[model samples]
Target chain A: MTLKGILLSASMIALAGAASAETRIGMITTLSGGGASLGIDVRDGFLLALEQAGRDDIEIIVEDDEQAPDVAVQLADRMIQAEDVDIMTGIIWSNLAMAVVPSVTAQGVFYLSPNAGPSQLAGRGCNQNYFNVAWQNDNLHEAAGAYANSAGYTNSFILAPNYPAGQDALAGYKRFYEGGLAGELYTQLGQTDYAAEIAQIRASGADSVFFFLPGGMGISFLRQYADSGLDIPVIGPAFSFDQNILQAVGADALGVVNTSQWSPDLDNAANTAFVAAFREAYGRIPSLYASQGFDTANLILSALAVADPSDEPDAFREALRAADFASTRGDFAFGPNHHPIQDIYVREVVQEGDIFTNRIIGTALEDRGDAYAAECQM
Target chain B: MSAILIVEQVLNGLQFGVMLFLMAAGLTLIFGVMGLINLAHGSLYMVGAFVAATVAGLTGSFLLALAAAMAAAAMAGAVIEMTVIRRLYHTDHLDQVLATFALILIFSEGTRAIFGSFPLYLDAPALLSGPVTLPLGIEYPRYRLALIAAGLLVALGLWLLIAKTRIGIQIRAGKNDREMIAALGVDIRTLYTFVFALGAALAGLAGALVGAIQSVQVGMGEPVLILAFVVIVIGGIGSIKGAFVGALIVGLTDTLGGIFLPEFFKLFMEPASATQIGASLSSMAIYLLMAAVLIWRPTGLYGVRA
Candidate 1:
C-alpha cells in the first residue's frame, strides 16, 4: 500500500478513537403511559443541565422504562452490558429502583438516583455504590407530619395505597405528629375510586386528613376528595400534588397543603437558574423529579471535575462519595447511607394570577433522615 | 361506621358501579356479537380521552368537547373496523388477540408522537361544579350525582333500544345465529360494522366522562379496561343486565372490601400487618368472587353456555 493511503486510514482511525473516549451516562425513566408527564420533566431537566455544561466529552443514553420494574431491570442490564454505560441514573418508582440497584451496584459501577429512595436502602440495605440525589422516601411526609403537629391537628386520619413506599410515608408522618389518631385507611395500590375512603374519612370525623397517593392515584383522590365535600383539610407530600397533578386537578387543588424538599419557587440562585432554564427548554416548570434528575447529573459532573475522567472504577467511586455537586437545594450533604440531608418545606397550592403553583408557606423541617436510619450500618 | 359514612360509601359504590357498567357494556357487546377479543379496545378509550382533552383545551366548552370526542372515536372505530378488524372477523381468537395487541402499540406510539408524552386535562362544566345537599344532610358533588343519574338514564335508554326496536331483534339474532341470519337476506357485514361502532361509542362515552375526573394520557384506559373485563366476566359475556349486576358487585366489593377488610384484619393482626394483608386481599376479592362463580357455574352468572 502507498504511504499516502496508509496515512489517511490512520487519521480516520484516530478521529473515531477520540469520539469513543467521551463519558457516557445511561438514564432510564418512565416516558410513556400515565407517568409520562413527570418523566418528560425529568428528561428535560437532565438534558438542560448537560446542555448548559456544553461538553462534547459526555454522552447520554436515554431509555424509557414504561413504569414497569421488569422493563427497568432489563434496560439497566442492556445499558450496562451491551452499551457499556459508565454511570446509571434516573428512576421514578421506588420498586423499579430497588429492582435495578442490586445489579448495578454489584457490577461495581456508579449508580446515582434522581428519585425513589426506598427505606430499606436508606437503612440496612444501604450501599456505598448507590448515591441518592433526592430526599429519603419519608423526608417530605415527615415534614408534613411536623407541620400537622404544629398546627394542632389532632384526631387526623391517614390514607395511603398499600405498598412499601406508602407504609414508609405513613410511618414517617406518625413519627413527628403526637396527635390523637382517628383512623388509618390503606387502599389497594392503583385504585381509581376514592368514594368509600372519603366516606370513611368523614365518618371517622378526623379534623384533618393526610395521604400519600402519588401519580394518577393522586389525581383521582384529590378530585374525588373535592367532590365528596368533606370539610377537612387534605395534606400530603409533594409527590401527591405537584406540577404533574396540578395539570389535572387545576383549581381543585387550591388550598391543599403539601411538603417537599424542592419547589420551583425556591428563591436561590442555583434553583432560579435551574427553573428558568428548564421552563425555557420544556415550556413548563420542573417538578421535584426533574430537580432530582438535574441534581444527579450535576453531582456526577462535579465528581468528574474532581477525579480524572479517565480514572478506574475505584477512583470514580471515591470521588462520588466526596459530595461535590452544586445542588439546587442549596446545601446538601450525604449521610452515611448515601442518602441526602436537606431541608423540607411546607407548600400550599395557591393561584398566581391564572396559574396554580405551590407557594412555600413555611419551612416545617430541615436536615431530616429516614426514621429507620438509626438502624443503618453504613 | 356511622350511618352517614355508611350511606356515603354505598353511594360511592353505586357511582363506581355505574362507571363500570359504561365500560363493560361496550366490551360485552363486542365480545358477544363479534366473537372477537379485541385487547386494543382500551386504546380506543384512551384516544377518546385525548381527543376530548385537546378539544376542550381549544374550545373551552365541555359539552362541545364531549360531543367531538364521541364522534371522533366512533369515526375512528368505523375506519379501523373497515380497514383492520373486518379482516380479522373470520380469524381465530388467538390471531385476533395478537393483531389487536399490535394495534395497541401502534396507537400508543402514534399518540406519543402527536401529544409528546404529557398528560392533558379536561375540566368539569361550571353547571355541575359544586356540591348539592341531599335530604339526609349529606353533601355530594353535583357532578357525581349527575353522573349516576346520567348512567341510569343511558342504561334505561339502552334497554328500550335493545328490547323494543327492530334493530335490537336483528342484533339478538346476529348474536345467536350468524349464518342463519346471513342466509335470510340481511346484510351481515353492515350489521357487524354497526355493532362494533356502537360498542366503540359507548367506550368513548365512558372515556370522555371519566376524563373530567382523571388525567387524559396514553394507557389511561388500561385499568378501566381490566375492571370492565372483570365486570363482563362476572355479569356474563352477552347480557347487559348481567353487566349491570356484575358492575355493582365488583364496585362494592372493591370499595368496601378495601375499607372494612383492614379493620376486620386489625382484630387479629397488628395495624401494619393488617393493612398490608388486608389491602392485598381486598384487591384480590373481586377476582376471587369471579373464580368462585365460574367454578360453580361453568358459564358466568348470566351467560348462556355456547
Candidate 2:
C-alpha cells in the first residue's frame, strides 16, 4: 500500500479508538485548602499506577474542589455532560462526595470512589453505578471502638467534628464499643482549638480518648493533648495519624493507635512495591489516601482490561465485583454494596530515625464488611 | 460543674479573650485609623506563625520565635501597606474585600510552595510545658496561665501607649480627620505604615504565641480572623479600649457557653440530643451575644458616633 493509503487507515483506527479503545477518567477532589494533601496523595498514587501499567488508552482529567460542595457539583456536571468522561472518582470529603456521586452516577457514569465513602451512599442510597474501593466512612472508627473494647478501655471520651462523616464516626464507635462513654463531644468542623476540649477530658478523668478529627484539626488536638500531659491513651481512626500529617504531629504522635485497612508496612507484595515506588517517586512515605488512590485506579484498569465498562455496563460491574487487581492491602473483596470488605488494623505511630510512619500493632477487625451493606437493597 | 472547674473555665475564657484582643487590637486600629477593611489581616497572622515556627525550629528558642514573628509580620505589613494598600485607601469597602481576599489565596499558595502541605511544629518551651497546680487542687496548663498574664501585660502596655503617648494622640486625631492630620504636616503616610505594621506585629504575636498550642499550618489565621472581626464589631470598630473589653466578653462567652450549655441541656433532654443541641447553640452563642448587643446599643458596647 502507498503512504497515503496507510495514513488513511491510521486515521480510521484513531477514529475507531475514540469510540471504543480509550478510557477517560475525571477526578474531583480537594486540592487547594486545609485538606489538600489528601487529594494530592491520591492523584499522585493513581498517576503512579497508570505510569507503572503504561497504558496508552487511559486519559485522566483532574480538578480541585477546594473542599466546597458547590464546586464539586459544578465540576462533576462539566465532566459528565461536557467532557463525557467514562468514569469519575477522587472525592476527598463526604459532603463533596454526596453532592457529586448521586447526580454523576444517575447519568449512568461509573464512579470509582478513591477516598470518601459516606454512610449515606453505603446503605439505602447505594447506587449500582458507584463502587467505593475505600472503606465506608465508619469502618475504621467502628474498628477503633472494637479495639478500645478489647484493649480494656472501660471509660472512653469520644469526639468528632460536627459533620455527616463525624456523626457517622461517633455512631460507628458506639456500635462496636461495649465501653461506657465518659463524654461524647461534637466540635465545630475545621476547629483548631482543642484546649477547652482537653480541659474537659482531663477533668472528666476518662481512661482513654477516641477522636476522629482529621487533617489540621487532628494535629492541633494531638499536640495540645500531649502538651496538657493528661497521661490518657489516645486512640483514633487512621485519618488523624496518617503519614501525611504524622511528622507535624511529631513526638506527640508516637504510641497513639489508629485503625486503618492499609499502612506503609502491610507486608504484602503490592503494598511493599507501592510504598517503595511511591517513596522513590515522591520522596516520602505514602499515606492511606495514597493507597486508596492506587487501589481505585488499579480497580479501574483491571475492569477496563476485562471489558469496556462504558460499552457494556453489566460486564464491567461484574469485573469490578471480581476484584481482579492486586490491592495494596493483601486481601480484599467488595461487600454487597460495592465497598471494600477486608481487615482493618490498628497501627501505632512509630519513629524510624528522623522519619515517622505507622506500624501495624494488631488487627482490629478481620474479614469485615460495612454495617450498612445489609441495608442496601442493591 | 464544680467551683474549681468554673474557675478554670473562666481562666480559659480570659485566655481566649486575650488572644482575640491581640488579633482585634490590630484589626480595629487599622480599620479606625486607616479606614481600610482588610480581609488579608489573617494572612499576616499566618505569616507571623509560619515565621515563628520556622525560626523556632531552627534555633530551638521560643523567645527568638516570638521576636521573629512580630518582626516578620510587621515587615510584611509594612511592605503590603506601602505597595498595595496605600493605593486602595480611597476605594470603597468592596474593592478592599476583593483585593484582600485575593491576597489570602496568594499567601496560602506561597506558603504551601515553601513549606509543603504539612503542618509545622512549634512546641511550647520546656519551662512552660508543665501544669501549674493552684490551691484547691485545680491543675491548669502553665503555658495557658502564662499566656493570660502576657496578654494582660500587653493590654496594659497598649493602654499606656494609646492613652499617654504623642503617637497615640496623633492616631486618635487621624481617625477623626485624616485630611486635617495630613495638612498639619504629621507625615500621614508614614504613620499609616507604622499603624499597619503595629497591627501586623500584634496579629503575628498572637499567631506565634498560639501556634505553640495549635498546629501551625496554611490558613491558620482565617478562623481567628472571623472571631477577631466579632471582637471589633462588639468593641466598636476603632476603639482599643472597646476591643479589649469586647475581646474579653466574646472570649468568656464563647468558652463558658461551650462547656455549660451542653451540660445544661443534658439536664432536660437525652444525653445525645442534649450534646447535639448544646454544641450547636454554643457555636451560635457569640453571634447571639453580638445581636443582643446591637439591639441594646447599635454602635456596640464602646462604639461612638462618627
Candidate 3:
C-alpha cells in the first residue's frame, strides 16, 4: 500500500472509527466568479444550521463548483468516492444541478438540493434518492406574473437570456400574465450592454418591463435601463435583485418588485431567529439562498437524528420525507415530487439605511406546486 | 418602426460604435507599433474600471474618476511593459499571447482580492443623468450624447496628433522600421512603453465612462475586448482610421441587426422561430462581417501591403 493510504487507514482505525458512524455531507455550490456571493451565503447558512443544532457526529465537506457543471460533476465524484459522504447537496444553478444530481443519486447517496429545482428533475427524471428543499425554477417567475396581473399592467416588455432557465422564466411569467407583450426578446447569455434592447423597449410602448437577467447581468441591465431614462416600472424574479447584487445596482433597483419563496420578514419564530442570528453571525442579512441552505441542513439533521442513514436507509428516507423541522419560511413540507410547496412573496427593493434591502409587500402565490410534478411516478 | 424610433435606434448604434472605437483605437495602436498581441488588454480595461469605481466612491466626482482611471491604467501599463512586456519583444506571437493570457488571470484574481467579488458602483453625474430633447424631437440621455461627443473629439485629437505632432511621427517611424528608429537616436524602448500606456489609458477612459452606466466588476472588459479585437481585424491591424470605421461597422451591425433582423424574419416565419434565428444571426453578424471582409481583403479592409 502507498504510505498515504496506510497512514489514512491507521488514523481511521485509531479513532475507534467514530468517523465511520458520523454522517458525512458534501456541499457543492458556486463559490467563485459571478455567483460567489450566492454560494458563500448558502455555505454560511448551512454551517450556521449545523452550529445551531450543535451536532457533533455529522461531518460536512464543502467544495466550490465555480458555476460549471463539469466542475460540479467532478467534485460530486470525489465527495462520493474519496470522502464517502452519505448525502450530497448545495447546488445553486439549475444547469449544474441537472448535470450533477442524476449520476450522483444513482450511486445511492441521498442527494438533497438546497436550490435549483429544474423541471426535468420534477418530472420523469425525478429519483427516489433526490429531494429538493427549494421551489421549482419557474415558481418565482410565475409569482412575478401573478404580481403583474394584480398590478394592472396591460403591456410589458419581456426579455431573458436564451437558455433553458431563461426560457422557463418567460414561460412561467406568461402562464399567469394577462397582458399583451410589447416585445419578447431573448438576449445572448452574459450580455452586458443593453442600450439596443432598452431603445427597442422604449419605442414598443410597454408600460412595464419584466426581465430575468440574474447576477452581474442584472446589475448591468438595471444600471443602463435606469440611465436610458425609461421610467417604466420594472419587475423580475428575486434572483435579479437579490441582496448579493443590490449594492452594485444602487438606486436603479429601488422601487423594483420581485418574487421569492422566502423573505426575512415572515413573522415566524423560526424565521425571526434565523434572520437575527444570521445577521449577528455574518454581519449581513440572510438572502433567499441562505434560507434554503439553512433549511437543507436542518432537514438533513432531522433525518440524521431519527436514524443513521448509513445503517437504516429506508427509515432515513422516511424521516427525510417527514421533514420534521421548523423552516425559516414557516410551515414547509415536501410535495410528492420532493420539492417544496409553499407561499412565494412579492418584495420591493427599498433603502434600508445606507444599504439596499427588500421589504415583503405581499404574498403572490400561496402553496404553489410545480406543473412537472404530475409526471413524476415517484 | 416609427421614423423617430428608427432615428433613436440609429443614434443608439452610433453611441455603441463610438464607445467601441475608444477601446479598439488603443488595441490597434499597440498591435501596429509593437507587433505584440495583448490578451491582458481586457484586464487593463477592468483595472481602469475598478480604479475609477474606487476613486469615485471616495471622491464622488466622475471627472476625478475618469482622470484616475487614465493615470492608473497608464502607470499599470508602464510597469507591465517594463517588467514583462519588454522581455517578450524578441519572442514570437505565441509566446507573447501566452504571457499576456497569464496576466489576465493574475490581474483578475488580484483585483478580486482587493475589491472583493462584489461589483462596485459609479454613478453618472447628476447633470447628465436626465434626458434632453434633440433638434429632431428625439429625447436621449444627455450623458450618452456627451459620450458620442467626447469619443468624436478624442478621435479628432488622435487624428491631429498622429498627422501633426513629433511623437506621432516617431510612432509611425517605429511601426515602419523599429531598428532604424532605434539606430537613428530615438529611444525605441521608451517609445514602446509610451505607446502601450497610451493604449491602456484609452481603454481605461472607455472603462471609466461606461462603468458609470454599467456594472463595474471583474472581467467586464472581456466582452468589449473580444469586440475590440474584431474591430481591429476588420479595420486593418495597424490603421487607426480602420479601427474607427470597423468599430462603427461592428457597433451598428450589432445594434441595428439585433433590432431589425428578427422583425424582418417575423414577416415570413413564425415570430418565435424568427426571434430564435434573428438573435442567433445577429450575435454572429459582426463575426460574419469580419469573415466576409477577410475573404475580400485577406489582411483587412485597410491592410497595408507587406
Best by lDDT: 2
Mind giving the per-residue lDDT tens digits that candidate 2 earns over A32-144? 65687789889888878877887767767778887889999998998777667889999988888888899988999999899888899999999998999989989999999
Report clashes for each candidate as comma-separated counts: 0, 0, 0
Name the runs in model 2 displaced over 4 angstroms.
A1-21
Q: Quote the positional error of residue A79 for candidate 2 in Å.
A: 2.2
Worst 10 residues of 2 chain B by lDDT: B1-10
List of clashing residue pairs for candidate 2: none
Model 1, position A71: C-alpha lDDT score = 99
Ranking by DockQ: 1, 3, 2
DockQ of 2: 0.49
TM-scores computed on chain B for all candidates: 0.96, 0.98, 0.98
Candidate 3, number of clashes: 0
Go through the candidates in order and give each one's DockQ. 0.61, 0.49, 0.52
Weakest 10 consecutive residues of candidate 3 chain A by summed lDDT: A1-10
Q: Model 2: per-residue lDDT, tens digit, B1-306?
A: 667668878888999999999999999999999989989999999998999999998999999999999999999999999989998999999999998898898999999899877677688999999688888888788999999999999999988888899998899999999999899999999999999999999999999999888778888898889999999999989999999999999999998998899999989899878877887899999999999998888888899954
Give the candidate number with the greatest TM-score: 3
Model 1 C-alpha lDDT per residue in residues B1-306, reported as the tens digit of each score: 566766667777788888889888878888888888878778878888888888988999988887888887787778888999999989999999899889888988898899977667677788897688887888877887877887888788878877899888888888899999999988989988887787777778778888887778887787888889988999899888889889989988887787788879999999878977887898899999999888887668899955
lDDT of 1 at B22: 80
Which candidate's DockQ is highest?
A: 1
